[model samples]
Target chain A: MSAQTATIRGWGFLAPAVLWTLAFFIVPFVVMGAMSLATLDGRTLVWGLSLDNYRELAGQAYLARAIAVSLEITLTVTLVSVLLAYPLAWIIAYRVPPRWQRLVLLLAILPFWTSYVVRSYAWLLVLARDGVVNQTLMGLGLIAEPLTLANTRFATVTGFVHFFVMLLTLTIYANLVQLSPNYRKAAMDLGANAFQTFRHVILPLTLPGIMTGAFLTFVLCIGDYITPQILGGNTELTVPQVIMVQLGRRADFPLAAALAIVLMGIVTLAYLAMARWLRLDRL
Target chain B: MPWAYALALFGFIYLPVATLVLFSFQNGSLPVPPFNGPSLRWYGDVLGDDRLVEALLNSLMVALGSSAIAVALGFSAAYALARHVLPASALWRALLIAPLTVSYLIVGLGLLIVVQRLGLGLSLWTAGIGHVVINLPIAFAIIYASMGAQQQNAERAARDLGADEARVVLLVTVPMLAPAILAAFFLSVTLSWDEFIIAFLLTRFDVTLPVEIWSMLRSGLSPRLNAIGSLVFLVSVSAVLLLELTVFRKRRR
Candidate 1:
């Protein structure tokens, strides 16, 4: 029947993607899980069922601290990104007309178009000892020499905000754009002012956007090894660095696998929870 | 009230890029100030570096190859989801989005182990394979988003007119989805080009631009590196500008 053909066609269309996911995502995860039960005897991983890697993951003080630190950083960064993004999303949605709004949206996305390495390097120059931040601060008598923004947590967080805010703003705007302005106008006609209208109607409607953006930013911030590696000094070790150290340097593949699995669990849980609360597909 | 914060944020964004642009004009080796005079030596230097050029080609090839393949797979997934209420629509949607939620680092780690065991090892093909893995889900999401907005009843109309499934899909569905497909291609290219930890961790000899740039950073700055970074930036800026302008002009018309 015609309906039967559509269904078969649907299955046919889905075959490649399903195969890709199972092969890449499902199978690799199986390998990682299998690997984490291993103990590396030099170059050879003596892989029979074992719990040593998980035990090590649980016991290490530094590993625990690094994971905690990464969680903390992810939370703060997500909050900062969303906080900054809201007003911009508001302005873009309700304030600007269509033509100008498109241009502004383009500008917001502009930074991400370039290589992230180049963008971070640009940040490095701006934050270095003789960098622009200190120069300007000194010019205004805010500080005598450079503020030591480079190779610091501040620098890492700043870089996080720089690249991430645009994505958050856009996600929020996508939701905000479809919203009819009449609700706000009706509220205003009913004696609600700008603050009340925003607080009551606008915020509630855009809650889904905020949640989606926040979820993404949180997941990305925690998993990010690059920004923290480039900017964060030794004093601010994060979870990804620990995994890198284990795998790259010590060749402790089991431990690295175990650590990454834990991170994956956290990310997967957050994603599922977000999807349950607000359909993540809309993102 | 919020104006001050907006201004501060905008300033933070622009100043670093401006400094990078200025330093590219520096005549000497260092990226720091105390410049003598403006020169295009760095730009020349960037163009001259063989390693950088190789990396550039590697990035372009991988991005184009992965984006094309991934977009095809993605368009299929999107079409399936949009056109049918399959046995488990919500579950299928969830599975499609799972990869997007997982970090690129995890995906990289996962794929590296699988492909290495299969004898593919680390090369441009491996990198392209890895890119295809991660980009497929995103391409699906974007195309599906556009699909939801489209008027799909036309396809049904075409189908009722005695057209075959392929004919309906080929004649009606694809033309409607062209813009979304192109946008997905652009997005995939951008994502592939900017992806760092994955390519850096996976590839050995065949590196992407971000990997090349990262390694160069460890040895410290050079006019050559800056020149390369600038070239990468210039290309990125043009691609983004072109994509946005096309969409904007289309919207206007």
Candidate 2:
């Protein structure tokens, strides 16, 4: 085939994907950006260059609170999931027998196959007043009554942490298994204690993995509607929830678009912060 | 100590799923504790519920349809980018993969706006479109990463033998990348099958399983919900095990 023909064939092959991305991904995103700047006049959408939605974000306490609530919940989930997952990933990667490692890892992430919405609902049931957790606690004589565990920020955090710890463990474990033993041996030979060796040698090497997992947890957790919506009990709403309310209940697409853009902005900020360490391609 | 911690974390992870499955057999109406005698009544009810069954079929259709499109597009893009010396391949790859970074809610919301503005009614097709949008990047990534010089040399040889491009792709290139393509397709199916936000946003009456389940949850608690949740969990777990025993195990070997 001539080079010209090959080029034409290449374009032919590439056109579909390129057009799909441009039409669905790029065009929708551009429209969403424009929608964010447009305002709703009563119920009808007024298309214009206005910052009313954003201005409303600052002026409205409830809306501003959603941002704070989302940020707080996301940060907490990221930190706790990382701290909890690191040790688990460490134990699995180093302590588990090689033949059993795959099984162990598989078991760790097995529940990830379940419906994401159902998993959140399961947490709701488990954390319910008459649910397994409170029943168990009372059965053990740890409490006189069931603590209000469900329908709170705590429940939301627990649900988020449950999902993310499994995720972070996988990422952190991948980082752990890739480390050459020579690094640890070299550190031990240099009179470094075990703790010092880990702190100096292993920790830095795995920071990338931890950060990558944490960033993912932040993005997914912050953007998620199901976990917070089901468990949060509408006492407070996350950004995604608020965005959904805008779209579902009010049909305020412009405001919803603005909220989505804010969400996109937060994720972009996170990506920028973790760009140095993110090995998403590795995933 | 590590064993104890590992066991504890394992229990924590499995706690909800175990509870979900257990309550699925509850004879009572509520899914709470005080497990009643083992009963398949709720399972029977779930199986008989026309809407839930319809939603299940809808979910399957969307999952399979969207994943097929995603895999086809992803494979073609990967093949072209890998085989041809295209200009600015990196830029093209980046554009294709850009959706991976964006949130699903964002993607769904974006499409929802476009669809609404175009005065198109929401349906399973719109939701499937959203699924394709999200799954495409993932499919592309997996297929693109697996495209290596082995396929390249094989395709070159096919071309040298005077095989046309289509024949070369169908016979040689596709078979060479079968594992990656299959993996991508399966992964996309699994994702689209359980995906909620996009489907919830994009679909109206002919909703997928997740949206139906969401509505079910809103209508009050029931073991029927448990039965349905358990059913989905079982199906998914079975698929995972099947993949593990076959495709993943073969790949590892």
Candidate 3:
């Protein structure tokens, strides 16, 4: 078929996806923008094109603190997932053969494929006051009393790592899979040791993968509601949880929208920064 | 890596879930264990738990309804985008794909607000409607991307051979797009099944599994929840394997 005909044909196929996106994705965002403007009155929103909600919520000390906490958690989770993922990803990429590598990668991803709620709920079982971790520690005679692990920042960090490390590992593995195995081999042939070869050859090649993994962790962590709600003690609240709080408990629609918008804004800015800094699209 | 590291990972990831499953069968109440002997009692308990059973049914109703409707609507979108050229096609594709990047909680809130503002009468049905609406783009994008690589000549040939547009679409195009359509349906079901926030915001007394599980977890974790998790695990694994074998027809390696 002619190129013109093919182009026309492609458009015919593409029209549905375009229309779907317009109706659902683009339309909802516009609706969300409108929702952010209206005020809540006893479980109902009194709609008037007013910034009163935004002004009220944005001015609050609570939002600012929640935003910071959200950022801190995102950064911490991003760092932790990356830290755990890179080494394991390295082993799978460089050391393991293709067949075993696939198995290892599958193992990494199997949990993610399982129910997320189940996994998050499972964290509760593990970290409960008289939970498995404590029982094991006490049985081992490591501590006199069962240490407080559940409903702490430590538990949240562990949970995030458990959930997201696979994402980092997979992203990095995809990158490493594309890299030339001979780069490290060449470096080693030139008198560099295994560690030095990896440092010089493998690391530079895999930076894009690392960056992509970190970016996913960062973005996903910021929007996370379940993990923080499950594991984050009353000591702190992430932005998403705060939004849920305003919506669920307080029935504060205006504030929830404002917080949702603010959360989106934070994610947008972080994404833009990462994209610009890493030239992620090019990678 | 050390053997302990792998063992630790297994402990972290599977241990809690396994505990839930084991305790679900335990002759006693709680997963905290000491030689209490196994029992099929928890399944009976879970079966007897009206709220949990109701939640599971509610989840199925939503997932099936949303997946079916979204898959249809998304098929339309994919058909148009992949076979027909709309203006600024790349931008349109990006717009559809953007939600995959955004959080579901935000998406849920955004839709709830929008539906309420439009005075569409927000409820679980409308929430299911919103889910279909949200998932339509995902289905479209996945299908569109899949069809993009195929040659257009097959459809042209079908048309030239005296088939009508409808017949050509059905026999020629759909058969070609079968794998992608299956992928889209499976993805939508999995997504709807797993999605917590949208269901939470949209439902009242009747809630989806994820939302129900969230409430249970928030109060405290129990092994009964693990039985539910294992069921979810079995469903996903079976679905993925079935799709990969039939639709994909590609080896994992």
Candidate 4:
């Protein structure tokens, strides 16, 4: 085929996807960006360059608090999930029998197939006042009364951590299994103890993978609505919850768009910070 | 010691699900502790509820429909980029994959704005569109990664033997890449099926299972939620195991 024909055919194949993305994804994003700068004049949208929504986000104590709360919860979830999942991935990678490793990993992430909304609701029940955690504690004489485990930041964090631990385990285990046994052998030959080898050799090699997983955890956790809404019990609002309220109750599209833009900004900052280690295409 | 830790971690991971499934068989209304008779009452209730059943069917349609569109678009894009030399191909690839980085909430909210502005009412079709937007990048990336020199050679052979480009793609390229394509389609379906925020934001009266489940949760807590959740879990895991047994296992041999 001629170069012209080849290019034309290539574009013919590409146009459907490109047009769909541009129309639905790119166009909507640009419109949302514009909507963020527009104002609501008594329920009528006034479209123009105005920063009123952003200013409102800064001035309102609750709105400002939502941003702080989202950051705190997301950071905590990311750190805790990484700390927890890394050890699990290591155990599964090095400790499990080769024949059983796949099964073990699959079992680890099996809960992920459950409905996401249902999973959050499941957490709510598990942590309720008369829930299993409390019942088990009382059964074992660990406490006199049930602790307030549900509808709190702890519940929200627990729910987020549960989902992310599974995700990070998968990503980190993939990274771990890719390393040849030769690396560990070489480190041991250099008179490195197991801990020393892990610290100096394995740790650095897997840092990129860890970062990638942690970044994913951060993005998903920060943007998540269902976990916090169901598990949080309105104790505190995350940014997504706040955005939902804006759209659902107030019909405040401009403000919600502004909040979404803020969310995009935060995710962008995270991406930049972890850009060196991220293998987004690999996912 | 690592085994003990693994056991404990696995316990933590499975506790909620075990509770959810266990209470789904509870004879009582609440899905909490104080175990009662092992019963199928809640499961019966969930299946009998018309709204929940309707939402389940809606979720299935959206999952299958959106995944089909996403896979088709993704496959063509992957094929074009893999085969032909388009100018600024890297930029095009980046654009196609860009949505993977954005949050689902943001994507849904963005589309909500455009849909409302354009006076287009929200429905399952709109929700399907949103699902396609999110799943397309995933399908594209997976298929693109699996496109190899072996398929390229086969396509060339087909072309050399007096076959047209379309025949080469349909007969040679697709069959060779069937595993990747199927994997991408199934993955897309799995994601679209369980998606919450996008469906919640995009749809109106006709909602998906996750959205319906959310409302069920809001109205009150019951074992009914547990029953439906367990059913969804059962369906998803069955699909996954079937794929593992049939597609992946066959490929490995």
Candidate 5:
């Protein structure tokens, strides 16, 4: 084939993907940015370059509170999931025999395949007033009455942490297994205690993995609607829940798009902060 | 101590699924509380609900339809990029893969804005388009990663034998990459099948199973919800096991 023909064929192959991305992804993103600036006058969308929606975000108590709630929930889920997952990944990587590590890791993430919506609902059932957690506590004489576990921030956090812990475990485990044993031995030989070895050597070495996992946890948790929707019980709403309300109830596309843009901004900031260690294709 | 901690974590991980499956057999009206007689009543109810059944079919159609397009586009793109030199290929690849980092909610919202602006009515087709949008990058990545020099060599041999580009791609390239292609399709199906936000935002009366299940959750608590949840769990687990046996097991062997 001629070089010219090969280039044409290459363009042929690239055209579909390029067009699809441009149409559905890039074009829609651009339109959404434009839509965010427009205002709603009595259910009619007014297309204009105005910051009314953003200004509303600043003025409205609930909108600002939603942002705070989203941030607090996201940070809590990210930190807690990482804390829980690191130890689990550590144990799986070092304590479990190599032969069983794959099986162990697979088992750990099996629930990942389940419908995410159903999983959140399942957490609701498990944390309900008469549910297993409270029932077990009361059965063991640990409490005089059933605690308010469901439909609260605690429930929402628990649900988010559960999902993210599984995710963090996978990322952190991949990092842990890739570490050379020589590093640990080298540190110990240099008279570092076990805690010192971990704190000084292993922790620093694995910070990239931790940050990557935490950043992912941040992105996913903050953007998630299902967990908080099912588990949060309208006691308070996250940004996603508020966004949904704007779309579902009031048909407020302008404000919702603004919220979505704010969300994108937060995720962009997170990506920039962790850009060095982000191996997205690897995930 | 490590074993003990591992056991506790495992319990945490499996608790919801176990409870879901258990309550699916609860013979009671509500999904919560003390266990009752084991029964298939709710499962029967899930099968009986016409809307639920229709949603399941909708989910299947969307999953398969979107995945087929995603894989086809992704494969061609992978072949082109892998075989022929293209200018700014790295930039193109980044543009293609940019959606992977963005949240599903944002993607759905963006599509929703565009659709409404265009005055296009929401339907399962729009939902399928959204699924394709998300799954295309994944399909591309998987197929692209697997397109090594070996495939290129085989393609060259085919071309040298006078096999046209179309014939070479259809017969030689696709067959060689069958496993990866099938894996991407199956994975995409699984993702779209269980996907909620995109389908929820993009569709109208016709909804996917996840959207259907969301409605169920919102309306009331029922053993039927448990049944449907367990049913989805069963179907997904079966697909996963099948993939493990066919794909991963073959690779290992």
Candidate 6:
């Protein structure tokens, strides 16, 4: 085929995806950015360059509190999930028999196949006043009365952590299994104890994997609406919940778009911070 | 000690699901403790709910439709980029894969703004579009990664034997990359099926199962929710296990 024909054919194949992304993804993003700057005047959308929505985000206590709550919950989820998942991954990688490792990992992430919405609702029942956690505690004479585990930040964090621990375990396990046994052997030959070998050798090698998983956990946790909404019980709202409220109750597109932009900004910062270790294409 | 900790962590992971499935069979209305007779009453209730049934079908259609579009578009893009030399190919690849990093809420909100501005109404089709947008990158990456020298050699052989470019792609490249394509499609279906925020934001009266389940949740808790949730879990896990035993296992061999 001629160069011209090849070029034409290549572009013919590429045009549909490019155009779809540009029309749906890129164009919508640009429009949302513009919408964020446009103000609402008594239920009228005035489209132009203005920072009224952003200013409102800053001025409103609930809105600012939502941002704080989202960050706090997301960070806690990411940190706790990583701390928990790393050990699980390590155990599965090193302790489990080779034939059974895959099954173990699959079992760990099996619940991930469950509907995302249903999983949160499941958490609600598990943490409800008369639910298993409280019932088990009372059955064991651990408490006099049922505790309010549902409808709180604790519930929201628990839900988020549950999902992320599964995710991080997968990523961290992939990373762990890739390491050569020679690395550990070499470290031990250098007179490193098991703990010292892990600290200096294994941990450093897996930092990229840990960061990648943590970043994913951060983005998903912060942007998530269902878990916090169902499990959080409205005591405190996250940014996504606040964004949904603006869209749902008031039809406040400008403010919601502004909140979405803030969300994008935070995710961007996280990407930049983890850009060195992020293998997005690999995922 | 490691085994003990693993057992504890596994217990933590499965607790909610065990509770959900167990209460799905509860004889009473509430899906709480004080276990009662295991009955299929809630399952009967969930299946009998016309709205939930409709939403389940809608979810299936959207998942299948969106995943098909995503896979087709992704395959062609991957083939073009892999075979032909396009200028600034890296930039195009980056642009295609950019959506993978963004949050679903932002993606849905962005599309919602644009749709409202364009004076367009939201529907399952719009939600399918959103799913395609989010899933295309994944499809692309998976297929692109699997496009290797082995496939390249087969395509060249086909072309050498008087096969047209279309024939080479349709007969040679596709068959060679069937595993990757199938994997991508199933992954996309699973994601779009369970997706909440995008479908919630993009659809109207014709909502998907997740949205319907969300509304059911907001109305109040019941064994019905547990039943539906368990049903979804059972179907999804069975599909996953089937794929694992069939496609992925064969691929490994």
lDDT of 1 by residue, A1-283 (tens): 5678769878999888988888878889789888888898878878879998888777988988888888888888998989888888777776777878877777766666657887777788778887667777888898776677888888888888888887888898998898897998899999999999989998888888789888878888899888888877577788888988887879887888888989988887777777755756455
Model 4, span A79-164: residue lDDT tens: 99999999999999999999999999999999988889989988988999999999999999999989999999999999999999
Give model 3 RMSD, 1 decimal. 3.2
* Collision pairs in model 2: none
- Give residue B34's error in model 4 in angstroms: 1.1
Candidate 4, position A148, lDDT? 96
TM-score of each: 0.91, 0.98, 0.90, 0.98, 0.97, 0.99
lDDT of the candidates, in the order given: 0.81, 0.92, 0.75, 0.93, 0.92, 0.93
Candidate 3: list runs displaced more than 4 Å: A1-20, A39-58, A277-283, B1-7, B148-150, B249-253
Candidate 2 — what's its lDDT? Answer: 0.92
* Clashing residue pair totals per candidate (backbone < 3 A): 0, 0, 24, 0, 0, 0
In terms of lDDT, which candidate is stronger, 3 or 5? 5
Residue B63 CA error for candidate 2 (Å)?
Answer: 0.4
- C-alpha displacement of A244 in model 4, angstroms? 0.4
Tens digits of per-residue lDDT for model 5 on B68-145?
A: 999999998898898889999998899889898889999999999889878999999999999999999999999999
Candidate 5 Cα deviation (angstroms), residue A144: 2.2
Q: Write the per-residue lDDT of candidate 3 for residues A57-140, one digit (tens) a residue.
A: 658888788888888878988888887777777777767778687777777677776787777667767787787788888889
In order, the interface RMSDs are 2.0, 0.8, 3.0, 0.7, 0.9, 0.6
Error of 4 at A8 (Å): 0.6
Question: What is the C-alpha DockQ of each candidate?
Answer: 0.63, 0.84, 0.53, 0.88, 0.82, 0.90
TM-score of candidate 6 to 2 decimals: 0.99
lDDT of 1 at A283: 50
- The sequence of per-residue lDDT tens digits that candidate 2 reaches over residues B1-253 is 8889989999999999999999999989889888996999999999999999999999999999999999999888988898788999999999999998888999999998899899999999999988988999889999999899888898899989999989999999889888889889989999999999999989998999999999999976678888999999999999889888887887887
I-RMSD for candidate 4: 0.7
